[model samples]
Target: MRLYWKVVLINGAVLAVATLLLVLGPFSVSRHPVVSEAVVLGVGLLVMLVTNSLLLRSSFKPIEKVVAEYDAMFERLEDERAASSARALAAQEAERHRIARELHDDVGQQLTVVLLGLKQLEQRVPPELADELAALRESTRDGLDDVRRVVRRLRPGVLEDLGLPNALASLANDFAEHSSASVRRVVTPGLPPLSPEAELVVYRVAQEALTNAARHAHADGVELSLTRVGDRVALVVADDGRGFDTRTDGDGLRGMRERARLAHGELAVTSSPAGTTVRLEVPSS
Candidate 1:
């Protein structure tokens, strides 16, 4: 029962016992009672108070035990969930690395050979074919560079070698090279060191967001930021362009959310007539 009800019950019982004794006992000899009504009532109240205090004290142990068990169980479950997520992220990263290696060693090498063959043919072919061969050569170069860039961004070797700052600079430079707008990256120092998984998540999300801004958003400029807020790290990518409605979930948006979720973080995209902003927060704890 609730403590208030228990107190009431105990007080009632004490009052009943006191009243019964007072009425059942003989009357006082000098027209006064031996156990006065005030005395009986006061003693009953005191007894009720003491008994209630003891009852409450006894109840505390069980409550604490239940709370402690709940906390322990919740903690264990959380650890399991976090571990599962980490494994999934590791698997994804491994696959990305494998694909990048295959592109660099297998497909990339073959493309280089084909370009060499085309150059050799251009030298031997007729003078009338010269213009066509030149066009083909130029096209091949652009296509190969584009493919390398896309593959590199999908899985950047620079990120593994030079860390996030250098990787972001390279990534931004690549984007700016391909587009008219200048892409700026500001990586604040003194930020907490992120695990490899967290770094990948941030980088991938920024990459996609920048690509979207340059290709579709028609933004003249974009800013990418990486910083720490208290015990949490934050990544913000903003663009000054015709903003998009965030409620719509395109492939890029879905990819961004998956990256955040893989890193055990939260993502939010806010866009309006002014601009678009993608914010990510990942807590160390």
Candidate 2:
């Protein structure tokens, strides 16, 4: 039977017995009827209260068990989701590294050979067409440079060789050179060494934040700070520019958020007309 109906039936039986004893049985044995009836009524009420407590406990036990099971299932599902996201991020990084290597080794070498051949052709050509050949050679060199930059973007060698701090420093330096904005970096010394995957997530989040600050916020100045917060490491990127609404804005913010989640971290972004700040916190171990 349903828990509610079971509780109701049990209480009704207790009340019915109490009522019969208080109304009929007590009267038959009583000489002073008024006092005896009062005493019997009080005893019946006390018995009813005790019986109700036991019945209620039994009735609610199954509901409590079901609630506990549901909570356990939800926690398990959340753990699975986090693990899945981490695997996907790792796969993506591996593919990017492979493509970057191919671009540098195969495409870059071909472009270099083409540039060399062009130089020889320029020497053979007459002075009348020399300027045109020179321009073509320069254009080819430019294209080669572009390809190399793309390779760097795909997978930076510094990230693997120098570690996350130095990689971020290099990124900041490059951003300062390319953009009209100024970038200041403050990295805490003696930080706990993060796993390579976690480092990559942090680096990517910082990269995207800087890109958004320069491209969308049009900020004149930006600050990137890394520090240790309790058992976690925190990376904060703030810009002094018009801010964007995180809910409605670009995919760059969303990408950073996903990367943070995959790293078993948390990301918080706050924006206002005065400025914008992006912070990432991941466990330090």
Candidate 3:
């Protein structure tokens, strides 16, 4: 039966029992009652109160059970979703690694060969054409450099070759070199170990936060820190610049959040005119 109908029926039954007692039972209230009549009335009222409490409890039991079942169902669905996201992120990182390898081994080598050929050709060319050939050589060198940069971004060999600490240190140095901002990095000593996936997530989030600070925030100073918090490791990137609206989720912020979710971590972003901070916390192994 519908809950509303069950409630109505229960209330109706209670009212009927009360009416029956008033009409057919021995209890009665006079304009001025003696102690014995008052006692009898009090007893009847107590009986009615107990009966109503019992009925309400019985009627609501099923509802409470249903609510508990729904809560469990939702929890299971959330776990499944998180697992799926983690799998997808793993696949994405694998694909990126493959592409970076191909570019570095194939395209990068081909560009190097072309650059060498240009260098040889420049020596053989006439004096009139030397300037143009030199320009072409320079252009090829630039292209090769660009390719290497892309490969680095796609694979982050530093992260694999070194640990998370060195990877973050390299990132901070890169940011400082490319932007006007000064960066300070602090990694707590003897930190708890983190899983590979968690490390990558933290690295990516810090990278994105620093990129945003350099490109968009126009910050002059930034701080990147990794510390152990309880059983979890926390990565924080804070910049002293014009902050953005936290209500808006840009692509960078969304990507960070997705990465954090896959790692079973929590991400928080706070922004104001004074500065912006992106914080990510993940469990340690």
Best by TM-score: 3
- Taking all chains together, the TM-score of candidate 3 against the true structure is 0.81
**Residue-by-residue lDDT tens digits, candidate 2, 148-239:** 99999899789999998999999899889889999999999988778887888899999999988888888999999989888788999999
lDDT of each: 0.80, 0.87, 0.91
Go through the candidates in order and give the C-alpha RMSD of each one to the true structure.
7.7, 4.8, 3.3
Give the worst 10-residue stretch by lDDT in candidate 3.
78-87
Q: Candidate 1 on 5-61: residue-level lDDT in tens? A: 765776577567756766786533335545675576566568767865676667566
Q: Candidate 3: misplaced stretches above 4 Å?
A: 31-49, 126-129, 178-180, 215-220, 229-232, 240-254, 266-275
Clashing pairs in 2: none
Clashing pairs in 1: none
Poorest lDDT segment (10 consecutive residues) of candidate 2: 24-33
Highest lDDT, which number? 3
Task: Find the number of clashing residue pairs for candidate 2.
Answer: 0
